[model samples]
Target: MFPPTPPIPEELTLVVDGLTYAGLAFGPVDAPPVLALHGWQDNANSFLQLARALPDVRLVALDLSGHGQSSHRSADATYQIWDDLPQLVGVLDALGWAQCAVLGHSRGAIIATLLAATQPERVHTLITLDSMLPRPAKDEDFAKTLRAFLKDRTALLNRSPRQFASEQAFVERRARMGEPPLVSTVLADRALKPCDDGFAHRNDPRHNGASAVRMNEGQCISVLQALAMPVLNIWATPRQGLEDDIARQRALIAENVPNVTSVDIPGHHHWHMEPEPAEQIAAAIRHFLV
Candidate 1:
């Protein structure tokens, strides 16, 4: 059975480009790190339940730029998938960590895939939860995608975040986003911040903008094929087209990478936030690492 959640981890910060990146560090101080990266709009606390269940390995969950107490990017900068690589590497160098395992969810999983491919020496194993390398960019949609990206950027760049009257209102508002709605209170631990009027979410409005450039299917495969480390991919029930695409990519990884394990589990995308799935997922990771 799942145990009570552990105490909050110690707060840590890594500065890159003079901007502060916030993180939560748990487990032994000297153990090789198992870097935990949250998906878009989620914060370091997204890994709280997972970290609590994984005591054998050190886990450090980062809020990636613009999400939590971490500093927002320069106004001219965009949060492209590739843009995070160098800075993430900077985080490793700053911490004096030469090598470690990477546990990433969603957008962070894409980063982990890229990091392991590009900087194989720094990452030992790659564990992804409900996500994988990004979808390939289509040549036919380049102009359309760019137009959409600019339109969205213009609409979102100057907008201010909505202030919620109360935490309950905030939680309910988030539930309206889609199916298998995440637990609002669990999300609020990192998503909400007190404001003079009420509570405002810490997310950057610009994060809603789509990327102007994306990798093609072949390019994505090349990156995954480059990985010299073991890969563990966890999946929730398929949501249709997107999940099918990931399955195709996983097939490629299975064919190329020396070791690859894919597990299908029951839960929504935010499964790691729930006690039951988080416990199961952590047990799987604990066994994988050993």
Candidate 2:
């Protein structure tokens, strides 16, 4: 059986903090709203395939700060939990939406979970794709990670942007990065745009550096405990684990959050974009929303 085709939506931009962030809004304006957030190094367009598979819901997907068509900050600001709050709220206000259900992938999932926890009344329900509660790093490992991030940060700041000779050259280079077939296709579609100088990725390279923010396990648990809204947790198959730790974390969330459901979608971490996995996620969202 074929899934009903969702109405094709138009793209637009919303300005927040002097930055114009691009986004897509679909379905009827008055329909129950679903805010879809993309992962690190991804843009709003990443949700296109999944959004098209769902029905009778308003789906809004935004390019996060410093990614896609959004404006980048001049200073090296650490992209912290607080940074997302303003933008999320701004988006809702601009759309005249008082509350929304959220669907987030990876880093976007973390932000969505935090928002649902901190401001429960603003969220109807939450869905997190291939993301776990934030975990604290051991002091030694944390320091090592910080040092490595700083070294890369300095290198990125000093480096000049490079231009590809052609779109095919850039796409060929991307193919060598070992992305899953479906994810690579989605990425190839969204990340490249034609310019007079051939095709270039729309996102800023600084987004890679912005991803270094850290939060501890205790803080994550506190947020989970605070969540009063329903949540759907989706995990991808090639598990990232020490089984004991994973079990412990799941138990903690199940106990703390009032209405929590979990699903293991079959695919790698980037499954949200793969055809089968994306359909599964869309179905899950439709079920929860209805």
Candidate 3:
């Protein structure tokens, strides 16, 4: 049928701001470089399927801070979206890449959007899977949002990691959380760490905390308008269709960005992590890059 699946990628580690970032690097060293950013709660392995689909492009997928084998941030450091910029810059510096394409999924996609808008010169091409930007905040709800965030921050500070009795238990739990078994198994391989009692997730508890703030509508529009490089916005068309707000925002982004190509493929939110959809997405990315 298709080309044989690619082998597991080589592990890579980069130190930035005293934090160790873990990732997987694949494809030829001389091919066009593309940074891959996975969604929230997902590790570098999220791109495994997509990597298997596209053997021509060089891809480096990171676990980002607080996720997978990456070192967690200091106790005082927050997990805000913008807080990742410095680490990203460091990763780029380590790779000696002055400019390259970026591929992001869900939460990672939003971060990529922000990066493309704020540091347009460093990102030559942007490809976002199933997201454009974070949910916009309303002025009227600012106070309430701040209070909730503070409460969440305090509540999760002392929370303990959840453990699973066995490997199957962990995979089943992850499956119940929405991912298919195939996808869950791939993710569980990296997300689960052996403990005294059982295996527990390695992600930082603070990663589950609420964000302190989100950009407002006008601010998001400004970001959309700031994208000067070619952008491929690929979103899944769920059976229920896109949510009104998300659809509206996606439309707004496409309208504001000068060189954006929008493609809606049939699948769910984590479609890029699935076998069939990953093929379709990889094809779209390959064509877009060309």
lDDT of 1 at 221: 78
After superposition on all CA atoms, how large is the RMSD of candidate 2?
2.8
By summed lDDT, the worst window of 10 consecutive residues in model 3 runs over 1-10
Q: After superposition, how far is residue 288 of candidate 1 from its true place, in Å?
A: 1.0
lDDT of 1 at 99: 94
- Most lDDT-accurate candidate: 3
lDDT of 2 by residue, 1-290 (tens): 22554346678688866767787888777888989888887777678768777657888988887676667655656555457777788788888888999888988988898878877788989998877565555545667777777876776764534456675666567568755545655565556667767776766665566336466666667888888888998877766554566577678788788899988777777777655777887887777777
- The list of candidate 1 runs beyond 4 A from truth reads 179-182, 238-243
Global Cα lDDT for candidate 1: 0.83
Report lDDT (CA) for all predictions: 0.83, 0.74, 0.87
Model 1 lDDT per residue over 85-120, tens place: 888899989878899999999898888888889999
Error of 1 at 32 (Å): 2.7
Clash counts for all predictions: 1, 0, 0
Candidates, ranked, lDDT: 3, 1, 2
Model 1's C-alpha root-mean-square deviation from the true structure amounts to 1.7
- Each model's TM-score? 0.94, 0.87, 0.96
Q: Please name the candidate that would achieve the greatest TM-score relative to the true structure.
A: 3
